[model samples]
Target: MKSSRSITTILLVTLFLAFFLGSASAQEPVELQWLLIKFWPEYDDPSLLVIIDGELATPGSELRIPLPADAELNAVATAESSGRLLVNDWREETTADGKRILVFSPQFPVFRVEYYTPLAINGDQRIVDFELPAGYLSTNEANIEALLPPSSKDIELDPPADEQGPTQDEVHLFQRTVGEVKDQAIRQKITYVNASGALTVPETASSSGALLQPTPPPAEETQDKTATGITGNPWILLLGVAALLLIVGGAVGLWLTRETDENEALPAASPAPKIKRKKRSASTTIRASQSNLDRYCRNCGREFGPDDRYCRYCGAKRQTVP
Candidate 1:
């Protein structure tokens, strides 16, 4: 009887486990997807940037990508490969080559920004995430999910877009991939999550379309209380400004001190302008040329004219000029 009871308990536990997994299986099956998207610079050839969701995709570093037997990625050089990838403020340009390409090369045209480094494949899906710098932008997920195939449902979008793309808004990333199913390969739409937290369908895009405006940056991260503006470290800047003020103040103080020293070293104030006694002399007597001044009348050619009086003969007078 005890043995029978143990067997019954085992059966009951098995039943519960099976029920949980069965319900999950009845729901939608989650499949891994591979795709590429394109983005244009805001003004000139904008920097190429990529940001993936932690649960959806990984930043592909070409170091080595694991392509499943049933999956294949091609012509990543084009902009349509990513659903969340789109043009920044600048126009788009892709130069195709039989053997060489410009958009993905490390030099010149290709400037890539990768987020969520070193990715790993989890089951079928590989998840990765990253943030665009304060001034950069990435694709919108709402438009991308509209182009994806079945087997997955895109959430967090207001509504989905038509295959061509959302008419109201432009698609940022183009997603295109070839996946395998039941021994046959198929070309299909790629889906992924974007910054807006939506599963999006991306179309295999071509640099072929007319260029559009660049996407604006996301809301700034103000978690830091000390940042003054978007561009600088406030503490470093404050220090520099304070240093400059101190330098200017020090120079002024030193100049004032020197002026005070010179003033103190100067001769005593001239003795209240002394009055000197004059040596009386006859009108004809001549004194040293440099010491004493002589008065002369221009009209009469008379010397030592009446003190402060004009010569009667010449009508010319010598006043006390001093």
Candidate 2:
């Protein structure tokens, strides 16, 4: 029972250490802001940006935009642009040391949206559609048409002081900690410094290009999809057999591996015993004549033990010496 308890204790300590090893954060707070193109109406219109941290919006970080009269408000989250944004889901994250990360979509580069379902905008019937690859800024950076395909302008793009972007791995992980924040415009400052020097360029609404429109993709000169031999392609039976064989081989390999691991993990055999040899030992001592109380009787050579005052053999006497 003691040994079993000891094992359990060791396992618990190991599991505890492992748990803390992967915890997302152990230090102080971190704040992150993601630019959302919330209400872009023009091609090069300035984008709306939001900085989200937990559930609390940073002070003085609301978006400054003029909402049009009768414009239906709808927000569609997508993943497309840069091929890293989420088509639907957006998320936020942290590291073991607690560094915060916000992910955006890469597929839905530009997600066009209306706030209220079956919504309309600018007297135009806005289509509530979903595509892929847009980042946190899709709705906030409303006038993204300037960066759209027809324009793919040679506009000089200088990365943020710390240049980061959405990747295909995923985006929007921050939402995990951010919780639910919808349609509320949180205020924040967009600080931009001048390139040449001295002059600080204030962040004004981007008013540049035209609102991007959807262009039908070019017609594909497709190879003959007309099945030359098999209509539904029954020759694929051979491919199916090959795939089955591969699966079987993989299963066998996995089974063998499990068996090998089980064998290896079995408790090691008990240790062999150690043999030992022994040898006899001896000792000696001396006493004074006055202290010879334990001496034998000299007359008969019989032993005079401590209990006897005189020798039992031949009646030899014993005298006290002080």
Candidate 3:
């Protein structure tokens, strides 16, 4: 009985440890948010711009993402949010078709990685089509969005329900949630027009001119219409003339009143005071110099009365010159 009880105790402890370990693993499982792919085509060059943005859960700084083997990496950047690149340590390694890995160790647990390549050529039918990376778990339930460039006027997007058919910028959107699927495919075809078939500036200008051309009536017909309108509504013509006259009269009255008020408000300019000078005799000039009017403080540099003892400005003693 003792041995049996010991065995039972060991079994119970083992089961408990297994349960705890399983729960811990569950908690550490990765969570993927979204994968966005974008394509921009260049008319001058046959190449297209391919950009990818992916967000996933990472308990630690390390994260691994699989991409297509043929994908070209131009610039690789990571961020905590969209459009903002964060500092991270990253490297790329070629894997089998099942996995082409882009490994990153970001600063944060939740990381977004965006990278772009400008030299992806279209396959047959002038269409650039491919499947996304594999090894993504369906349980993560990640969302996906694919954008196609403007060069392709005639474009087709799969899973039409999720298709936001060509936007004004000519980019198409394939936005949807990744379900229990292992791989996602994106296909795009570009339709081109020859130079001769393309619209010319002169052609467009001619069409615009057609719209601007006006159909004017003959001078005689226009004169007859004007005469008939005036005769038919004599009262209206008179009313208009009367309104014009009233407006003119009111304007004239306003001008006259304003002028009269202005004239009345201003004081008649008095003849600028006649600064008449009387001829001064020599004796008057001699008497003026005898008075204190010519006295000035030497120390303070101010004029003062002749009886002052100290300069008012500087408090200096004043001396009378003999």
TM-scores for all candidates? 0.26, 0.21, 0.39
Where does model 3 exceed 4 Å of error? 1-30, 41-46, 81-83, 96-100, 114-124, 136-139, 166-170, 180-322
Give the poorly placed runs of model 2, Cα more than 4 Å off. 24-322
Model 1 segments beyond 4 Å from truth?
1-106, 117-150, 154-238, 261-268, 271-322
List, residue by residue over 158-245, the lDDT tens digit for candidate 1.
Answer: 2222333333334343232222222222222223333332223334132222332233332354322212332223234444545555
Among all windows of 10 consecutive residues in model 1, the one with the lowest summed lDDT is: 94-103
Ten residues in sequence with the least summed lDDT for candidate 3:
199-208
TM-score of predicted structure 2: 0.21
- How would you order the candidates by TM-score, starting with the best? 3, 1, 2
223-244 per-residue lDDT for model 3 (tens digits): 4443345432334455555555
Count of backbone collisions in candidate 3: 0
Top candidate by TM-score: 3
lDDT of 3 at 83: 43
